[model samples]
Target: MNVRVMNAAVAKTVAPDKPAAAAPAHIAATGLAVDFPLEGRKQRVLNDINIAVPKGSFVSLIGPSGCGKSTLLKVMAGLVTPSEGTMTVAGLSPQEAVNARLIGLVFQEATLLPWKNAIENAAFLLMTADETIKKSEAFDRAAAMLKLVGLDGAEKKSPSQLSGGMRQRVAIARALALDPEVLLMDEPFGALDAITREEMSECLLDIWERTNKTIVLVTHSIDEAVFLSREVHVMGTGPARIIETLPITVPHPRTEESYSDPAFTAAENRLRSLLIESHKKGRR
Candidate 1:
């Protein structure tokens, strides 16, 4: 598929102007608006929002707290309904796509089943109550995934025995098992130590290169976004909206040495300036 058309999966509220008319998008959303009564209060959490994430691309959504970053992710995941607008996940509604098992999600916490060992936890997603892969197949696949995350020897360990980073790796492995066309990650490394977070970032980049699956990650770390994605969507402080889409031209496999590279520094500075300005305006 054409790269232009391949990247057309967008959230609702985006303009109708198509990126590549000759070859349309694999998935896209239009006029996506999400709102709800706060039970005792009348307030809106998200307004007309728009975004486009292309196939085999990695996009990060970064913004201040309570700006609906996670909520936006939930909408994309089809966990929350848009009060108005339309969203298509691989041309299917969110719930429909999820039921069809076309999506994968990695949350802030590992959320792995405590009782299950690493391999079982990794393949846990592949098994259905009524239908499941044979234990051998699950173990084989799980072992491969664990190996991908550098967790080979720990496959027999329980969640409780694993460190935070290990648990998150297991979570990522589980998500990849589904082979989702689009992976939705909500602050997957927020809880990890800076060192673990950096390690996970490199691991994630390696995995993305290997799988080439489209990923939409929600994170607070500007550096993380710059490091992990091809495009970083910076949102306005609140009434969250896309402020700017900073494309990382710095070639990937970006390493500790590359951090000193001018292109990387410039992109980080540009995003930081935009965010600082947004926060200022938010306060005003």
Candidate 2:
């Protein structure tokens, strides 16, 4: 796979003379910003952020800690309200989208219930979200989702019985059980070991391919972003804003061998350089 890095500015300015009609964006933000009160003063976190994620595509937001990458994701997930501008998920307001069950979110922690088994934890949301759904039906649906995430035989296992990676798989299964149109993940694999992280990356790619759900991941690892994203959006702090978007053109169904490919190396280097620059800018 030969990765081609496209500068966001150049791509925007050098559009096709007669651009073809494009599909509506699954998630979009215009002039998005967020502010928190600090010492009775407003502290801006995100500023003038704009983004469009094509339906069914995989994208990533990567930056230094506290760069508001996760905050941006939360905005898309309807967890946080922006102080300025607007955001839409699946062509509706973030809150509307959430009400419609069009968005699913997974965080760094698996947050599985200790007493419940895998199937029960996976079915918990479905049961709680809609009381009309019968327990048997929810469990069946959750079982299918667990199987989708490669946890077929672990339905009865408790959270303590599962490894970190397996727990995350259940977490992902729980999210997917909703059959959401978009999935927002914030460092879902950050706590795993190096090898497990790589494995989880492959697993996530498989899930994305199978489900074809639009995914926006927030990650601190450049390699992880390069491996999993169709485009890597880099953010700069000091009132965080997206500074660049790098399209990772590496071919899909990426395997372990893809990591050693020149294209992967190139994309990783490009992201690393951008982050280094952002870091320097943040410190100044």
Maximum-TM-score candidate? 2
**Poorest 10 consecutive residues by lDDT, candidate 2:** 12-21
lDDT by residue (52-75, candidate 1, tens digit) is 667778888888777777888898
lDDT of the structure predicted as candidate 1? 0.78
Model 2 residue 1 CA deviation in Å: 33
- List lDDT for all candidates, in order: 0.78, 0.87
* Candidate 1 Cα outliers beyond 4 Å, as residue runs: 1-27, 40-42
In the order shown, what is each candidate's alpha-carbon RMSD?
A: 5.8, 4.2
TM-score of each: 0.88, 0.93
lDDT of residue 6 for candidate 2 = 40
**CA-RMSD of model 1:** 5.8
Looking at model 1, residue 275 earns an lDDT score of: 76
Q: After superposition, which runs of candidate 2 have C-alpha atoms over 4 Å from their true positions?
A: 1-21
